[model samples]
Target: MSAARIFAVMVKEFTQLTRDRLTYALILVMPIVQLLLFGYAINNDPHHLPTAVLIQDDSAFARSTLGAIAHTDYFDIVETARTPAELTQAMARGRVQFTITIPGDFTRRVVRGDRAQILVEADASDPSATGAAVAALAGLPQEALKRDLLGAVAPARAAAPPFEVVVHRRYNPEAIAAYNIVPGLLGVILSMTLVMMTALGVTREYERGTMESLLATPVKPIEVMIGKLAPYVLVGLIQTVVILALARVLFDVPMAGGWGVLSVGTMLFIVGSLALGFLLSTVARTQLQAMQMSVFYILPSILLSGFMFPFRGMPDWAQWIGTIIPVTHFLRVVRGALLKGLGFADLWQSLGALSLFVVVVVSLAMARYRTTLD
Candidate 1:
């Protein structure tokens, strides 16, 4: 508790921190990055989501309902389908996020003073988007019904007839929280494990002088990188399998898509996350520093990646920042595949973004490692 001793310790700590260029850069860069990401990208309310209408009735009443939805500014009609099969195909292909179906007897039912049925199907894999779509659909028919009721009813003590709202919440139709959360848990688990593991892997070798000894051998940097990465890649796969099994067995989360696509997407996500960790490791001189840097990167990823909060609710700036993190795209791919039964054609954008992340992060890590090796 001596003042002199405390001052000396403080000085030593400052000297160590100053000598570590990576720690210094992280301290400087992390705040700005996190501020921008938190302030701009996170949004809970989303508008103008792409929607489709399948009008089998195609009558005045059907057109009125469609016009009401379209004019609300909540949805943009991207396509129209005349048949139910065609509408199903569009939903399966992820061409439309929300679908509206007006039964063939809609106009006749309304005219006959009977309740008409409208089927609203939403991709509930993304809860925020699904909720917004459902809310819009729920209100649309009610408003139309109210307007029609007012016109048909007597001015004195008019009573509204009973109507039914049929909401088909597709893919987690029950709005199971586990179905939404479990798939994302896989991404979060892998992000934490892979990034921290790989971040420490290279830095620990350098700190212990093993990296130099390895470099002295015939192994090239690329080979060393691959060798270092191979084991963790397997670890990532193991984690994926474990999580998938738990999700299915314990949580009853359905795997509607092919296992092959999930496997490939998981591997790609692991590679990208591992590369990002390796990049951090190349810059970090100590294992402790590497761990801190990994945390710094991971914190923002968890917050902004639509893991805990809804991505659609986030502001544009926050959403943009979330997009930069590999976890964001990975979550989309995993959840979309696992819950929505979506295929590569539907998730090409996320897949492509993950690929880009892998390339850029791995290249940066290699470049930095090369400089460190030389």
Candidate 2:
């Protein structure tokens, strides 16, 4: 109603906003971070995807065909497998996205026009990452042997394709998006709820004038931290069960691996998330700041953690940053356990990473709590 009063209130509010350094930084920094992540880091049509090759044939045609495949800029041959078992292990462990197997008599069969086959196996769990690479293969059979089919094999080149590209889409053979997304939701949901909830719960004590009473108590910092986080851990696990249940019943996502591995990984991630929340509470002066800090963490986790985009699709720097986030490792564990039928050996690195995150974050939260006391 009063123009002068309205102007005064607006000035006061702007001053208050600038004084809240965390919120001010969030406002200024979040947009820049989002722009960089989306512009530079995110790539749906990923190139140089890791590939493994098993060349049973040592002939010129085999070599020529592989040379053509490599030049596509889609598949990067990172490993050479001696046997089928090794190739299987590579895919199982998420080492390679595509595998090429040139049969023992590929050259002989191609020269004789006997419909020689080159086996191409792809990890189709995350279809978006593999789609372009797989599509690149369709043209390879027609174009790969064009040069080698000269002279005696000239007739071979003209007879349809010199070789067949037999593609086997591993894991989610149907390339169902739900297979990738549903399992990832467990990590995302747990990270969102557990971190925000734990941060708010502790910050609420300070807001409600209970923190002074808590400080007056005889309980130690570690004891208080554990007490605050324990309830949220249970809540996270319950959310995990509910999400997994809906994933199976609604989406029909496969639970391929053992429950034991999923259980251990889930617990580690939930605990780590709660520890991170506690750490944020130590840094944030109010519930709003705690919530903002949580968003700062959650946004990158959703983007760079391969929840929404392909992890391998991101640039090396983004991937490196992603590895430091617990959600990235948790997503791997969940997807491996649920979709790939991955065992402890296949998932050890991710599990170990999650374990390390829990230890480091909990230790940092404890240290931050000590600082809060001071």
Please write out the lDDT profile of model 1 over residues 114-230, one tens digit for every residue: 776788788777666667656766566556655544455423113233234588888878788789889999999999999999999888998898888887788777787888899
Off by over 4 Å in 2: 371-373
**Model 1 ranges with Cα > 4 A deviation:** 1-8, 11-25, 70-74, 136-139, 145-164, 316-321, 344-349, 371-373
The C-alpha lDDT values of all candidates are: 0.79, 0.90
- Worst-scoring 10-residue span by lDDT in model 1: 154-163
User: Residue 250 in candidate 1 has what lDDT?
Assistant: 98
lDDT of 1 at 141: 56
Name the 10 consecutive residues with the lowest summed lDDT in model 2: 365-374
Say which candidate scores most in TM-score. 2
Evaluated at residue 88, the lDDT of candidate 1 is 82
lDDT score, residue 300, model 1? 76
